[model samples]
Target chain A: MINPINIGSIDDIDEGEAKVIPSDETGTGEDIAVFHAEDGNFYALNDNCTHETASLADGWIEGTEVECPIHAAKFCLKKGTALCMPATQDARTHKVEVSGNDLLLYPNVPAEPVEA
Target chain B: MSDCTSHTSEANASIGRMSRPEAFTQNIDVSTLVDSDGGLIDRSIYTETSIYAQEQRRIFARSWLFLAHTSQFKKPGDFFTTFMGEDPIIVTMDKTKTIRAYLNSCRHRGVRLCRADAGATKMFTCTYHGWSFDLAGALQSVPNEKAYPEDFDRKQWGLIEVPNVQSYKGLIFGNWDKDAQSLEENLGDMRYYMDAMLDRDPEGTEVMGGVMKWTLEGNWKLAAEQFATDWYHVNMSHASALMVLSPTGRGPKAEIAATPGRQFGSENGHGAGFPTHPKSRFDARPVHEYYDYEALRERLGDAAVEGPMTTGHATVFPNFSYLPVNGSIRVWHPKGPDKMEVWAWVLVDKSMPDEVKDAQRLYNLRTFGPSGIFEADDGENWSEIQAISHGFVTNNVPLNFQMGIGSERNDGTYPGQTSELYSDAAGRAFYRHWSKQMNTPAWHERTEQA
Candidate 1:
């Protein structure tokens, strides 16, 4: 069963900005990073980078991709796919949905089976 | 279990299975140097003279060793002198702009030729016996030609040439084994990491400053393996340096111990590590700040510049290693069983600004140069271990390397075999590959079958 927790209102995050939801709120040991992409959509991923112990919430966000500040590993905010070397594993994406003014987030899940 | 199967085996398994010449396979047994589990390596391999000789024959002679960077020989007649094992070699560019390497010894009396480290020369004339060889390593002139018989062939007396010479990206490598695989084949999956650090920008990279060399009393493998797989030592080995360099004055022990990172193991014994936090000006080090990411992104694309490129340390099996974050590259040249000659060079992007390059050089000097704090710390550790291994009781004991053994699982994330950030998986892999190379009879035995 998926427990959807309300993080904040949609106005809490600015366009193209990212916020780190603490682990306590996400019910996971690792924090969750919520991104308000320039694509006019919301996405969430595990805050810690797979390549290292960096917080993706502290990374640079442009368009729909986030670049880790520590090693520069880029992850797509829309799908949480690792787009290059160094970071070979894609970030685990969290289920997110916006309901009016409320932003609801679910635990991270395996990525959708990539298309052949 | 995520079926942590080794991808390297699928791509490059047959490299060790090829048949070799009977002459090369006559006698050599390195089965004693490595344990059956591939976890513990025999310490005597570091102090035994006989084992060192075997290493020269099987490892150095057969492997694609680093020779010179392509930027070192930009003009015709340019030459750089380096070593393949203990044998001195000179890499030169001939009139045709083809790069070649030759034994730096003259054919006559076996005198050392080309005493200079690097220079543009039309020909190399042996000081002991005036036997001159052109840039192509051909015997162009010989003093007192009248003394020789008319039938004597000067063509046959050219400098002994390295059998294979190849370049990947801008780094040139040479191998003495004629049947050795190409540099690309030897590199395998390691190329991905190399490209991430080296080929990120289209402008390419270049070597800066002359070589800084120093000798240390340590086994070459100690230094090589550490660079390849030892991130666990940083918190303790470099505690004092971090304390001095830390902005908060809180020291790096707790921060480093708590930080999360990944340790990567690859085919052919290559290993690398990445730090959890990125080093930059905001972290109180102006020298660590990279070039403007936006500008680099424009040229290198988002994936190349902004992906797992911040490598804190890495090794290309054997002695070649580097720290991508600081652009410091080194080769742990084996001097003997108990000693190694370290040759390090600073690398920087060709497009970085002068101030940034200067700052970067200063950073390298402060952190990894011969007298640098970290270098001094590592030197002491390696040397003390070598000294301790001289004792019979200690030498017989096996070092522990069982960290994250059965826990290794692949998430289809990185290439090659991998474990946790602070694990001995890479170390085990290094020993495994070392054992394989050492036990491979001889270079000729692994040549392509007729």
Candidate 2:
């Protein structure tokens, strides 16, 4: 069953940044990174760095790239292409929906999903 | 110079035949190598100085050593620095999407060209003299162009190109010997096994993240041999994990106490030693239960999965080897005769679920990382073996490798390779090949012999 839960309010943040939403009663797993893109759209990717397994929440968010703190491998938060070396694989991306003031995330996507 | 030439010619006369006294002394008893009872050599070959040097020239230089996976350099200007043996190299993808590797040292002042872990840049400017090189390894500019003569050709001053660089199934390998066999020819039968691991998914496999690099105090061959066939050590080395995972009194101790051990050796010096019913009789309760054994069996096929899942290793000759059930690829990059940097990568099937990959990565870290339980035990033993072998007395003494000697029979499966899946002498064959390369004349002569 897919349980939709309220994570955070949209008015709390500015543009081109993210918020870590903790897995609550209706969430799937641990904290998920919810990003507010420059285009005014919110997206969520796995908060873990695909390189050294560091936390992406602590990484520097520049434009569309999140540079891992440990190895500095950049990841395109929207498409999840590990932009540099060290990280040869993409991070798992989650579906994010802004329902009124509540930020809803679906962590059902696999870490490395295979496309049919 | 005259004396050196004479020595060279004399060495050339004995090409393709073992003549070096050190080769015989360092390897198994010379009589046993040719005779039927050759598989008895233990971990001694892995530590021998003469053998290691020979491998550097024959196997490592000639054979294709894995550099980096292609996924690391997907962008035009992206680059990563790695080593081809002890030589520093920079791998880059150009605007044309073609991958190229060049010596990392600057041609002008011999400074390391690339220092960053990885990045995209139109040109790499040497921090020392301000010389710059494009992605294609061409020297683009010099700080003081007037300092050189008008006849100076910037084209001639490009970064030294490695002799051969190629990729097969996303895995890239670089070779130093220009006239050596192609990467395809060198891989040979090992390609089949690699295919089974890599080519399963249509999109092919990608390096999960960055490579895990660590140094272990042992000869490179020790790392290779352990991944090749040291399953016997696991029962004792990893006894704590086994005991914890095993149900009550059901473990390797009980199983070995009950029945004679079962071991299977493969052709071309690849083999494993463990009980026949590894899954049923062994203590794999923790890992086996958690992992999707059914999916593994279905994906790897019945024969690949039927082996001792708990304990087994396959050495693919020269440098690379892995234990599939263990979920790791071990590469022993040679630093020197006594030291090697062990590069281990956790391999997961592209088709596996995300949670499974995460679980496998965690399991791999706990089992094989620098601080891993199993690696800690193995590292101590490897270091001790190297220290002991350095002794004048211990070095001369012939290490016993006489297990399952004459019992091995030719299965007629692999050509130019022998199979003895149940013997300890499989390691002896590895050394035999080692001695053959070490004792043979230089590459020119060996090529002529081939």
Q: For model 2, state the Cα shift of residue B375 in Å.
A: 1.1
Q: Could you give the CAPRI-style class of model 2?
A: incorrect
Pairs clashing within candidate 1: A70-B278, A72-B306, B20-B445
What would the per-residue lDDT of candidate 2 be over residues B1-450, giving only the tens digit for each residue? Answer: 010000001111222233444434332233332222444443445565565655655566555666777767778888878776676889888788877777789888889988975677666667776687777777866655777998999977877776567677767777665555566665555554455456555556555666788886788767666665555566677777666556674554554434333343333444444334444333223444555657656775654444434445666566676655545776777887778787777776566667666776777787776877777888888888887777766765666555666555543432233334344555655555555555545454455446
The C-alpha lDDT values of all candidates are 0.75, 0.62
Question: DockQ of candidates 1 onward, in order?
Answer: 0.01, 0.02
Estimated TM-score for each candidate: 0.71, 0.65
| iRMSD (1 decimal) for each model | 25.1, 12.9
- Cand. 2 Cα-lDDT: 0.62
List the candidate 1 regions with Cα displacement exceeding 4 Å: A1-116, B1-28, B36-38, B253-256, B278-290, B294-308, B445-450
